[model samples]
Target: MKRTALSAAILLATSPALADTPNTDDAQTLETVQVTASRIAQTVDETLASVTIIDREEIERLQPQQFTDLLEGRAGIETSQNSAFGKTSSVYTRGTSSDHTLLLIDGVRMGSATTGGASWQFLPPEEIERVEIVRGPRTSIYGSDAIGGVVQVFTREGRKGPPKVDAFVGGGSFNTWETGVGVAGGTENTNYSLSVSHFETDGINVQDGVGDEDRDGYDNTSLATKVSHRLDNGIEVFGSILYSEGESEFDSTEGDDYTDYVHAAIRAGLRLRLTDRWDTELSVSHSRDENDRYTDGSFASQYDTKRDSVDWLNEIFLTDHLLLTAGLDAREDRIDVDDPGFLGAEEYAETSRYNVGGFGILQADLGRHLLEGSLRYDDNEQFGSKTTGQMAWGIQVAEAWRLRASYGTAFKAPTFNELYHPDIGFFRGNPDLDPEESETFELGARYSVEPGYLDVSIFETRVDNLIAGFAPPENVEEARIRGLEIEGGYERGQWLSRASLTLLDAEDRETGNELPRRSPVTARFDLDRQFQRFSAGGSVIAKSRSYNDRNNDIRLSGYGLVNLRASYQIAPEWQLQASVKNVFDKDYETALGYNQPGRAAFVKLRYQQR
Candidate 1:
């Protein structure tokens, strides 16, 4: 599970007050934002979608070592983890299922076709440049897996300056250690960047009362590179690659097990300005998510999934205030699974499939009012054909106030494994499963001033044909989720503060039971202060109780955690940092029967060329 970004709607969601000082790419202004909400790079004052942006500066300021550290406890986001180390991680946006949310890297979708989710743990934070989180349904623009929202990660790229180098080394509890280095430089016509990182930790036990009690360990190494050049004819060509591989150990009911994983993304593209009013971009991408399982020191199973895709996008400007956009996306997903002899002699019915979708969007701005609409049609080899659409309206009701409303329809097709995997001893595929469909309605209000901002959003979503987890999974469930989000921030000179709160009512329509692993209430607060050469900050994250099972027979206790951090400037290009997590050592569980890390501490040394 994983990612999303900034815009008015963002201040309260991402709470940049708690993130870091604003960089060029993440200005705290309504006239700024590169949001995925519309794929048009609209200003915050113009977009209707709720967005959150976290840039490199914030990523470094937070000193995160895991994907959860980057997004956990934020407004509209609920995350569950099996261990403190790199084990199984899940992120549910607006109470949607794990597979309902889509993960993208530089506009390219990346995840496992078999599981329909990303291997978030293997994505090294050091390779990322920024993250954008968009909440709400986007099936009209992204095809499937957008019923909940989209998480897009922008990898680090070269900056226009002399050669620059950034590096860090750190260590903490659980016998953990990490280090990374990056170099970037660019000229008027060309740019390039490369980065590398490594992390290892003696993780905690995952199966508390089950078969394996040994401490599970994790190790990961990653690399990222990017290059681009501008031609005299005003055409731009670029390429980027991100690769990460790691090993994770965990506990299962059967016994102790380990997994080797490799997750990667590759992209190449061309941007062209064909005419005075027309612009277009053509790109191709590849993504891979592979996992090999070993039980009792022997290979037991393997899942290798790959995705290849191409996109052709175009934009036309008819008037100063009106724009039209169109695009075509074609993708193929292929999966290979090996259970050795456990799956008998039957092979998968369909190991590969392809999908093609075309979409168009129109936007108009009339002074104080904004209107937008989009429609898409998609054809899948297995699911046949489908159509989706959305409409959004916004207006500046007052000089300092803005309001918006939107309604959208979305859908998600079953993964290959869910529909075609051969019958095995423990699991079976449901060839008759139907695609999940959903619709959502949302309303929002925002208030902003020079030094502070506030925003609120309320939404209701209904999903049908929800998949059940029984053996031979079936689409025999329904769900309803209604929620409210409030976020606000204030910055006065050296003091920066922000807070967010979420109230959710997610339940199964059939049983009227609370959705599993979804807390009804969650909140976060962050405060930071800066001195001439020193800085300090702390955060508090709290969540209400939730159910661990659909029947409501299991309860997960609510808990709160406090974390503190401090940093000192050692020189113009060097700094030292120290931090503590779970300051009070609170005993909590985001997932049932999983051990969580206790009070832990870390120290880091950093260097950057200015």
Candidate 2:
């Protein structure tokens, strides 16, 4: 019944008489511009990659307190939620592992070399102005860690005008409460924004015998600041600092885990028109991250790591139809892990890893055809050297149709934990692990209908030497994965709808066993409508059953979850919003052994002015 309703809505959206004057502020046209698809910003209609952008208004519409929640329902995307407030969530793309994707903040890499992945919990929603997601390999533009794709989060700091403050507070089920406040303002030459938020909850019960305290809960606090200064001669300097801390209890153990993390970055750039018909820019940035994890009581385990890096990028326009870009990046990481109970006495292990890479990309256009190619070379102190490449092309087949195709190669180095962790525990890192590599191919087309738009893509990726750890005795090894994604959306005036479906088939060629944690099928649908002073929407996510552990010890039964939201504009500057998540109180889990929230509601009020 719901599927029928969704289909009917799509059909009605493409019918005649649905026209409404395009409001530039709330509507999406065919010529919308996006920057993450390509290193150089270009109109989305003219770009050659699969990309998605969530602006601040839409982010507010969903009322997601954290930025990570906003990314879960998109195409070629997957999110794992453990408990309500305590667990750190992870994302996957195109059936790829979490570590295969890269996370960036205003072009600064936030991934940790020690973990070979990102701890995304530190990012709070209030400070984000927008999020750009580019799907597929991005070796040409982003270099390493761009295997699956790149997610760039831009903060809200460069607003125009006098000082202003934005704040929100809300409460929901399971004793959940949230509060956030931020301030931003700018002059002709300077701008800055600072924000802080807190989230806490008394989680629900997953098992009958498990006490509410056993299911436990989590508390998270985050603070972030972004600032920029403009100088004479088209030069600018910018800096940002982010800090977050989380404390939460475990389900089985009567203990808690605490994590403290920080990220800081600064950049300086000079943009100049070198000559007539020629333009160029040079920029340099430095970034660092420090992270520490601690556990309480008898199960105490500790890890600390730090990363420092620098990057230089140069771009030039040689002609109207051609552009060139070159860049070099380097990073060094130091990690220290302590085993309080090891080999009669406590032992400490330390490791250092360094990575350096150079990249180049070329873009050219000839009439209705556009071509792009990118290449990168990286040298790792522990894994030796590897080179990755990508090529893409776009063609205007008809006045209303555009076609695009791309192919690329990506590689991932071994993580510090994978190389040095103890061999007798639940997880034993393989010291002789090799780098993993894969080749991905994608084809897509987009058509502009009278009142809306339609887009479809088919993709396949083959991975080799996939790094994964198995049970005791059997350590980490490699595997392969292949998948397909279908996504479409339509919006006509007050009504908007979107859907994404993914099918994956992956296996371990070595053992001929099905890959663990690979969900066979997943899909999501979101529908929304706006009428004069009020708007309402709802979404449904369906995931297929899959295993929870690498050794296939646990299994999770897939299910469908629903969410609904509504908002009313009382005045031009004042509004009220409310939302209900997990409407049916479904008992489900995205991660094995961990419980999730059920039947929650949140109400909020907001004020804004230009």
Best by lDDT: 1
Give the TM-score of each candidate.
0.94, 0.87
Model 2 TM-score, all chains together: 0.87
- For model 1, the stretches where C-alpha displacement exceeds 4 angstroms are 1-27, 253-256
lDDT per residue for candidate 2 within 516-581, as digits (tens), equals 666778888888899999999988988888888665668888899899999999988778899999
Q: What lDDT is obtained when candidate 2 is compared to the true structure?
A: 0.67
The CA-based lDDT of model 1 is what? 0.82
Residue-level lDDT of model 1, residues 1-610, one tens digit each, is 0011212112111111112222432223564455578876654555788776777876777777687787887779888888777888888899999888888887778878888877777778888888888889999998999999999887887866798999999999989999999999888877788999999998887767775777898999989888877799987778888888989997753555789998898888877778766777788999999999988777888899999999888777777677777899999999888877577567789999999999998888788898989999999998799999999999999977889999999999998778887777567788788899999999999886657778789999999999887488988899999999887777788887778898999999999999999999998887888898999998899999999899999999999999899899999999999999999999999898888998999999999999
By summed lDDT, the worst window of 10 consecutive residues in model 1 runs over 1-10
- Each model's lDDT comes to 0.82, 0.67
**Could you report the Cα RMSD, in angstroms, for every candidate shown?**
4.5, 7.6
